[model samples]
Target chain A: MRPIVLATDYGTSGAYVGQLKSAIYTVAPGATIIDLTHELPEFNPRASAYLLASFLEYVPPESVIVGVVDPGVGSARLPVVLEGDGYTFTGPDNGLFSIVARKLSKARWSEILLSSEPASNTFHGRDIFAPVAVQLASGSTPRLAPAPAEDRAGIQWPDDLHEIVLVDHFGNGVTGIRYRPSDQERIMKVHGEKVRYAPAFHCVGPGESFWYGNSNGLIEVAVREGSAAERLDLKTGDPVGFDAAG
Target chain B: MRPIVLATDYGTSGAYVGQLKSAIYTVAPGATIIDLTHELPEFNPRASAYLLASFLEYVPPESVIVGVVDPGVGSARLPVVLEGDGYTFTGPDNGLFSIVARKLSKARWSEILLSSEPASNTFHGRDIFAPVAVQLASGSTPRLAPAPAEDRAGIQWPDDLHEIVLVDHFGNGVTGIRYRPSDQERIMKVHGEKVRYAPAFHCVGPGESFWYGNSNGLIEVAVREGSAAERLDLKTGDPVGFDAAG
Candidate 1:
């Protein structure tokens, strides 16, 4: 069975994540559901988009990746299916899919039509996206109509967002900037602190702040044996910049 | 394939939960893993025990529930398997499973004999607990020997604790007290505040503090449309009291 990956802001503590999984299991009892992360910059799809995209390479190619940071749920935003680079995507038409679409070559956008079934205005993640994800993951096509990728939200957004997209439990700040090898020579500036490059946590002294390419290929800020978030006063949506190391 | 349920203090943001899942999937590719919750009271298996026991009713009886809150990771703590009330559990031989065992009838304890395989000392959740959970869930029992249940950690702990065991994302404080219908007329006192009973959040005015039997059948303190944790200055390990409501 094709795996189903869930990315959402519903949070793990609440019933929302459980309800979403139930919807999927109700449809596909044998489905393999992987929670990429439910704590996705709550309700901020623009920031979540980058984090979700960063995890794309780690997911199985046949996986159905469901991203649901829908702040405009029950609004004018349309539910969408974007299949690209051997993976299928399902979620609201908000910029949640924009970065993933751009990252995956030959992406095709399609709108998932409502089947005259009523859904909760506040929880389309469980009501709509989950079932559609299950359908695609089960090798069944959902009701869809070809849509213009250009008209999608965040289509024109920058490829690289120079902002903190997520903060891990270890207090490491994950930026939206996809790391390149040459980028390691630059100093990262965030919260008015200059963070030099470090290959790994052990490369720096305890409590020393540094930046490095994380496993997901995103530039991340961390402090050895301490919380970079606390040390730098960093949080999601905080601006970050790069400069040539002097 | 039998399902595997995970309950831990790994928190949602870190790689621990993902690594745990990956370990199970690596061995049992078709396994269905449910993350009961990764945000258990960190390193306090005494508190996590009550919270884990409360969630047992919601899990499928055939599940292999893995509970890990091992502060003694590589220490002298024994790794064990517990079979009880139609469910199988694998984790450190800590108090994490004590409350769950007490709640279930006809519980049996078994020690999981360590193989010659090298395992990580710090991440037994992934290396030890997960693989053992998958083994039991797959109908293939691991090497085990009968152990005395009385000698296990937390065997003498209270049936119901009066301290806060968890503070969820919504800021509700879930106490270790199991709700009884007759207790409705009683007032719960915590953090120097007296809280009356309410059947549901809707029964209380916005921002009004009240206690209720939450879905998991635990007595929980909450403030409608606001944060009970913030309002009462409540947190895990905080003591609570009960009094007859006049």
Candidate 2:
């Protein structure tokens, strides 16, 4: 079995993410669980979708990724299992998997029923999705009902985007726009400030904010030794355009 | 082999933690790495000390815990490894593991030589400690020169403390003081605000604030549906005492 990956907005603290891991461990002892990230912006399904699409490249094939940025957790939204090119995702139908569901070469989705594992009004991530993720890792295909691809959450985003998707610990803002080597000449502007293009952090001058390709291949805004997000007041979902100064 | 756990102030979204994991994977392929928490109060060793002391109980025995709350990351602080009761710790001797070193039975201390693994001026957690952790997990015992136990960082604090250790996403503050079920009648006072004790969150009405034992067995301050830390202006290291309203 491939590793079980967790992508959520559970942050680094609190007991939520740990509980999810515990749930997996209880069923699949010695299962490898990789935390791609747990710092997604809560209640922002589009950003979660974008992050999942980019981050899915890093996980091992056949891995089951559980993404739970569902703000409508207790709402009438559906629970789902989406099979991407080679990855499986189990989470809320609130569009968290929208981008991946559309971009993957082969995307097949099914609505999951949770009669055995009753979820609370909140935290279906822990109750419904986690147990289901363990069952998937255990090689058991649980019951699945049909759901239209249009009903997927965050399905409206295009295959690529030009907005901030993540702000890293160094305050570098990772944009949803994939980097093209041919487009290194293209600079990005945010909040009226022009950012030139740099290939990596050390390539830029100290305290100068520049765009670079992160390890995950997203175009990221960063300073040499300082924080780009702080220097430019950039955050997730902030719009970007071709720098007028260019 | 026990899982390798990580606890640090390396906030989510940095290439820092990922780099550490990548370095570990380079040496130990398919290693199971668990993130205990990364939201520690950076530069505050005491808070990290308290958090490690409490959180260690949950990790698997014989696990190598790479704790990296190194405010003095590049400083001359001695890099050390501690063999605790059933687990091992690797990080700077910067007091992050002070509590666990003292309390764990048969604790052995040693200074780690980094000549084999040259550490950069910054981010020893990635270059030095992470490699050492991988070596430990690989079942290879590296050289450990003798070091005085007193030389351990942050060893001055007592076993039991009365300070706040963390504030979670829900605005709940996790305190260093362990909850004695017998002391339920003893209300806790923080910043002169008295907080009555409740066995659990559901015991209180909506929007009500109370102290309860979190799943980790630590006493935490929380509001039923609100944020206790936000409402009370509580933060890590705020002193806690018995309420005068007794």
If scored against the real structure, what TM-score would every candidate get?
0.62, 0.62
Mind giving the per-residue lDDT tens digits that candidate 2 earns over B1-246? 456888888876668879888988888887878766778877888877877777665566678989888777777898899897879999888888888776687788888876664657788988888888888887887777988887676767877678888888878888987777887998899888889998655567778898876655668887875778888999888898777665
lDDT of 1 at B158: 96
Tens digits of per-residue lDDT for model 1, A51-77: 888767656567888888887878888
**Fnat computed for model 2:** 0.12
Top-TM-score candidate index: 2
State the lDDT of candidate 2 residue by residue for A83-161, as single tens digits.
8667889998887888887768878889997677453445577678877888888788878887878766666777777
Candidate with the greatest lDDT versus the true structure: 1
lDDT of each: 0.85, 0.79
Q: After superposing candidate 2, which stretches have Cα over 4 Å from the reference? A: A2-9, A12-136, A139-246
Model 2 residue B98 CA deviation in Å: 2.3
Candidate 2 CA-lDDT value: 0.79
CAPRI class of candidate 1: incorrect
